[model samples]
Structures are given as structure tokens and as C-alpha cells.
Target: MTRFSANLGFLWTDRPLPDAIRAAKAAGFDAVECHWPYDTPASEVKRALVETGLPMLGLNTVRGDVGAGQMGLSALPGRRDDAVSAIEQAVSYADETGTKAVHVMAGISEGAEAEAIFIENLSVACDLAMRRRLTILIEPLNAFDAPGYFLRCTQQAKSLIEHVNAPNLKLMFDCYHVGRTEVDVPTTLNKMMPVIGHVQFAAVPDRGPPDHGDVDYRPIFSQIAGLGWDQPLGAEYKPGGDTDASLGWMVKFR
Candidate 1:
């Protein structure tokens, strides 16, 4: 069977962290992931895992000045130290919590200089992540969501990974974004899976569960199982109603 990993950050926004874990357990999730354990500190993160017995599959690293247009200055020529420091913090946090992967937020300004900067910073992050045994993943946001932001597709992400040539550096293949931008899902998935370290999904336009929107998760998940992807498929979508109410559909399939 294809296993499912619930994203606690989206699933239980209205509830407490402990309650979210219990809900996932009752909903029949095998594992879970989160965006970042911001409100829930490291000790609380550990406690939630212990109390719910839910293994954390993955989480994200912090992006410096995300709101201040300074997202991902790591690759820029002069800001390598800042990037390295950011990566170290995320790595240490991952180590303490038993998570395997972290999202390298590729936030950047719009211009000719952005690409060069991203490449430089990502290369350094990869080197550091390799030492930490961490699979540092880069996610491509759809242009609609991030107009000036760099990295808007799987092919672009794959190129960066190949150029970096580090096994620890990989792509975060988010389906919801892909669904709107790409013509075919499975075909694109097959082409990109080689460098893909993580995946995220929401219904195409609405960012809801599979059934609520046009994307049929059953078929996609079936293909995922056929592909032998044993890693967790992150359900990082907003709920149409109360978070738990929208998840009954997920419980049936998971």
C-alpha cells in the first residue's frame, strides 16, 4: 500500500500540537511533516512525537528576511557566510528531532543577478548538508504565487541540482503548483523523480484535498506506489472547513 504522511501545520491549524498528532493517529496516518516548528519549540516538538508516537518525516528551514526581500542571499558572492549559518541552524534542528530533510527556501529578488546568487549559495548549502547527512531540498514555486521569486518549475530545479552535482541536493516536487503549470502530471513526475527528494500537493487552483479539487489523488498515489516511492507524500493543503472535517476523505485512502 502507498503510505501517507499528514502535514500537521495545515491539518490542525485551529488545534494544539498534541491534539494534531492524536488526530493524525486517529485519522490513520503513518507519519507526518510540518513547514517549520516555529510556535512549537524543539522540546515541544519532541514531546509531541513521544506522546503521539508519530515520526516526523520532514520539515523546513528558516529563510532570512523572507518578508524583507532578503530571502536566500546564500548564493550571492558576498553573503556565503550568512547562508552557511542558516543551513547549520536548520541542520542542528533536524538532528535533534530525528527528521531527514529540510526545504532550502530559495527566496530571491527578480533580476539577472538572482540565478548566479542562487547557484553559489545552494552549492555551499549542499556541501554543509552532505556533512550532516541531510537531503537539502529546493522547492520551485509557481509563478502565480511568487512573481519575482526564482525557481518556478521542476526542470529549472533539476538543472540546479545537476550543476551542484551533490547527491544531498535535490528538488521538492510540489504537485499543486505543477498541476497548474504543467500539462501532464505523471509524465513530468517520471522525468523529474530522479532528482526529487520531496513532494507536496494541494488541489490545483484551490489548494484543497484531492477530491475537493480536480486532482484525483487515488490515481496519482497509485502511480506513486508503482514508482516505488516509499518516502512520505506531504499533504500540505488548506482545508475547506475545519481542518479535521476536510481530512475524512484522506483517512479513507490513507
Candidate 2:
């Protein structure tokens, strides 16, 4: 069966992180993940995980200066210090909460400089996470949603992972982003499965529930299962209204 992880970042936004973790358990999710949980203390998050017995699959590094339009820091030139700080913070939190991975966000930028800075920052992230026996992940955001975001394609992410040369560093193959930017989802997934550390999905174009998307996830989920991916696939969609009301798809998908 294709188990799912509720992405607390988007799933249960109305409540606290601890509360959201419990809600995911009640909703039958096998695991949980988040975007940025820095504001919520690690102790509280840890307590909730212990209470619910749901593994925290992963979480993203902080997006630096949202007010300044910075989505991430690692890829921005002249911001290596900030990026390293974000990566360290994320790894520490993940370690405390028993999370398995950290998604190092590459902020908006482009060209050779951005790529170099990104790789440098990723090396730092990988080294820090390796100490905790945690995986470091890089995700390719779709151009439409994240224009100018440094990492924008699976090929680019794969090449960077190779260049970084860290075994713990891997790709976060978000199906919705790839489906929006690439030609075929399963083919791309099949080709990239060897380096994939995690997977996520949402409705393409709409970023809603997978059940009502341009890309059908049923076959893709089965394909992943066949490929020996035993971890819970991440549900990172935005619930149009109350998150509870939007969970019908989970039942059907499961």
C-alpha cells in the first residue's frame, strides 16, 4: 500500500504544529512533515511526536527574509553565512524531533555564481546532517510557482547532487512540480529514483488534492512502490478550505 505523510505546513495551518501532528495521526496519516517549524520549540514538537507515535519524515530550512522576497538562502550570492545558519538550525531541530531528513531550500537566483554557492551550502548541510545520520534533500520548484528559484529541474538537482559528492545528499522529487515542468512523471521518477531521498505531491496547476489533478497519482504511487520506495509519500497540497473537509481524497488514495 502507498502510505502518505501529511505535510503540516499546508495541511493544518490553523492550529499549532503539535496539534497538527495529532490531527494527522487521527486522520490516518502514516507520517508527518513540515516546511519551517523554527518558531515552534523542538521540545513541544518532540512531545507531540512521542504522543502520536508518528515519525516526522522531514522539514525545510528557513526561507530567509520573506519580507525581502527571499524564498531561500542557500543559492543567493553573498548569503552563504545565512544559508549555513539555516541548514544548521534545520538539522538540529530534525535531530531533536527524530526527523529523518532536511530539505535545503535554494533561494531565488541564477547563473554560475548561484550554482556554486548552492553546492557549497549543500556540502555544509550534508556534513551537519550526516552527524545526525540524517539525509539532506534538494527539491526542484516549478518555474511557474517559483520563478528564478535556483533549483528548477530534476536534471539540475541530480547534477548538483553528483557535484556535492555527499552520499547523504539526495533529491526531493515532488511529483506536482515535476509534472508541471516535465513531460512524463513516471518516466522522470523512474530515472531519478536511485537518488531520491523523498517524494511529495499535489494537484498540478491548482496545488490542491491529488484526486482532482491533471496528473493522476494512482499509477505513479504504484510505480514508486514497485521501485522499492517504502517511505511514506508526502502530501503537500493546499487544502482549499478547512483541511479536514479536504481529506476525502486520502481515503480514496489509500
Off by over 4 Å in 2: none
Reference-based lDDT, each prediction: 0.76, 0.93
lDDT value, residue 85 of candidate 1: 76
**On a 0 to 1 TM-score scale, where does candidate 1 land against the true structure?**
0.89
Model 2 accuracy (lDDT, Cα): 0.93
For candidate 2, write residues 147-246 as lDDT tens digits.
8888889999999999999999999999999999995899999999989999999998799989976898888888999999999999999999999999
RMSD to true structure for each model, in Å: 2.3, 0.8
TM-score per candidate, chains pooled: 0.89, 0.98
Which regions of candidate 1 are displaced past 4 Å?
16-18, 66-79, 110-112
